[model samples]
Target: MDTLLSIFDVKLAIENLPFVLSGLPMTIAVAFLSMGVGALLGLFLALGRGSSYRLLRWPTRIYISFMRGTPILVFLYVLYLGLPEVGIELTAFQAAVIGFGLNSAAYIAEINRASLNSIDTGQWEAATTLGIPYWRTLGGIILPQAARIAIPPLTNVFLDLTKATSLAAVITVPEMFQKAQIVSGRSFDSLTMYITVALIYWPLCIVISAFQERLEKRFSRYVNE
Candidate 1:
């Protein structure tokens, strides 16, 4: 109790707060940026993953397999460090964002594919009866439903990305973990510094989880009622 309370001292940590908060914008920016990129790429990946034709599916499968199979650390290292050796230099932040975004795309693709599949087959048939084009029917009828199913897992991915941002520390992105390291170095209080960072992480995730629940309830209304 004492240790926890000690770490939560707003007054003592007040000066430290701005430094921590400074990194937050970047953290959140990278998170949202990555999610946006991941979602766009993932949409295609999901489509390809569920594609009926082998020609279309194989390439997508290979990309997903390669990304999902590799460690994120290894991916980052290759992009940020190794690529420079091959004369393809990238900024650490850019490399980290791309690496993590690409990885998240693989997982998001599977989530989207699963969610797309979860929609009732009759929903598609109903759209067919309306003489809607396939793409139009998907946009107008199917996607909204799939989005609801996907939201919970997508939020789960958000939480994961939030935590994974810590990996940016390894590459000196000046994010929360990096700030913690700097403060810990100065205060020689690594324990307190990290505990505070952990506290911030926990609450953000809890909020995401709460919002996910609310969204699910709202979307389920057409059926539950």
Candidate 2:
């Protein structure tokens, strides 16, 4: 008990809780902003991947493959550190968002592609026979069904992005883990600070997971109706 208490330092954790939590907003901001960018770009990539034109399909395929193959940390470093050498400057926050966003887009594009492809071919034929435009059919009929299929995997991506925001600390984005590091340095209690941050991340992930369950249930109900 004494050894554990010395290692954990509950009092220190409690005292630093608010300071660590002060970075929550930045963590959430990076996550959602990156998700927004990923979703939008990913959708276009999905569409291009399925396009008949070689120009579109091949390029999107290459982009997705390249992004997925690389580690996100290296990409973040490239954007935050390397870009300035090329005369393109970006702030730490901007670099984190763009790096995570672009990296996630590859994964999201694959998910979107699979979901879109799962829809029945007959639906497309039926819509075409009805003289509905491709865009309208996609927007009205296909995407809604595909979205339901996508929710689970997309939620997983979001969960990952949320946790992955901690990596932004490397770029000095001042997120939760970064704050924890500061506290650890000041107090000389790295184990306690890290454990505290992990506890904070635990509840945050739990909330996201619970929200995902609710979203899945709601979508299931819609589908049933």
Candidate 3:
């Protein structure tokens, strides 16, 4: 009982709470920065894949294929280590953001493509019959509707990216997991520190999930119609 109690170390966890939390800002920066950049890239990729031009479609396909096939860690390592060898240096934070952004963009592209395709073909025809410009029709009619469908899935991907930010620890970005590792290493209370990290992540994930649920409910009427 005493050994288990010592391992848990509630007092130490409480004492180091702020230290562990200090990395929250960096973690959030990485997650949201990736999501923001990824959304834009993903939108372009989706459009490229859907385009009639072989020049656009083929290149986008290859890019998505390569990104999806490669592991994010490998991408991170390539950016952080391989690039430096070629004189393209990147800070750990920059490397993490780029890696996460590229990875997230591939998944986001697929999700956006699926959502865009789920929109009816007749809508495009109707807009054409009305003599609407293609870009205007897409912007005013198609994308808004697709966005409603895409939000839930995109939010899920955002959450996944947030969790994956833990991988940044490998490059020493000093994110939440890395902070926990440092605290654990110093205190020799790995169980307690690790559990504290879980506790922090759990609440954050729950809050994001709740926001997604609310967004889904708000769009339910449009989907039902």
Candidate 4:
């Protein structure tokens, strides 16, 4: 019982609550900013991958492959440490955002591509039959349908991105995990600080997932109609 109880210290965790919570804003900011950057780049890459032109298609494919293939930690190191060797310097926050954003974009691009492909061919046929421009058909009709289809997966990706921000602590970005580390080091209560951090992440993911489910159900109704 002593060993089991020692595994977690609820009292210490509660005591450190305010200190760990202080990092919440920075964590949210990193996640939001990274995902925003990812969405734009991912959308662009998805369009490029779908293009018939070899120039656009080949490079986009290669980029997606490389980004997806590389580990996130390596990419973060490349941004935070490697870039400085090339005469480019960025603060920890900037590096975290850029690194995480670029990594998230590759996954997001694939998600967008799959969603875009899932769209009904008949919709494209009807648009083409009506003499709608390719870009207009894609932007106005196809994308809306794809967006609904993509929401659930995209929300999962966002949740993943939010958790990935913890890796920023490695580069000294002072996110939630970093704060927990600082508090734990000073308090000598690793288990409590870690549990507190996990608690924080658990709820954020739960909320995002709950919202995703609601959106998915709403979109399904549109499909059924």
Q: Could you say which candidate leads in lDDT? A: 2
Of the two candidates 3 and 4, the one with more favorable lDDT, higher being better, is 3
Put down candidate 3 lDDT per residue, 1-225, tens digits, no spaces.
999786688899899999989999999999999998899999999999888999999999999999999999989999999998999999999999999998889889999999999999999999999999999998888887898899989999999999999999999998899999999898888899999998899999999999888887887767677
1-225, model 2: which lDDT tens digit per residue? 999997999999999999999999999999999999999999999999999999999999999999999999999999999999999999999999999999999999999999999999999999999999999999998988888899999999999999999999999999999999999999999999999999998899899989888888877754787
Winner by TM-score: 2
Worst 10 residues of 1 by lDDT: 6-15
Error of 3 at 30 (Å): 0.5
Per-residue accuracy of model 1 over 1-225 as CA lDDT, tens digit each = 987676565554666867877788778777878888888899899999999999889999999999999999888889989998989999878987898899999999999999999989898898889888999988877887888889988988888997898898888787888898898899877777787788778887898789889988888864564
lDDT by candidate, in order shown: 0.85, 0.95, 0.92, 0.91
Cα lDDT tens digits, model 4, 1-225, are: 888678878788888788888889999999999999999999999989988999999999999999999999998899999999999999999999999899899889999999999998899999999999989998888887788889988998999999999999999997899999998899888887888899999998998899898888877764776
Residue 102 CA displacement from its true place in model 4, Å: 0.8
- In model 4, pairs of residues that clash are none
- TM-score, model 3 to reference: 0.93
Of the two candidates 1 and 2, the one with more favorable lDDT, higher being better, is 2
Off by over 4 Å in 2: none
Candidate 4: 10-residue stretch with minimal lDDT: 216-225
As for TM-score, the candidate ahead, 2 or 4, is 2
Q: RMSD in angstroms, all models?
A: 2.4, 1.1, 1.8, 1.6
The segments of candidate 3 whose C-alpha lies over 4 angstroms from its true place after superposition are 1-7
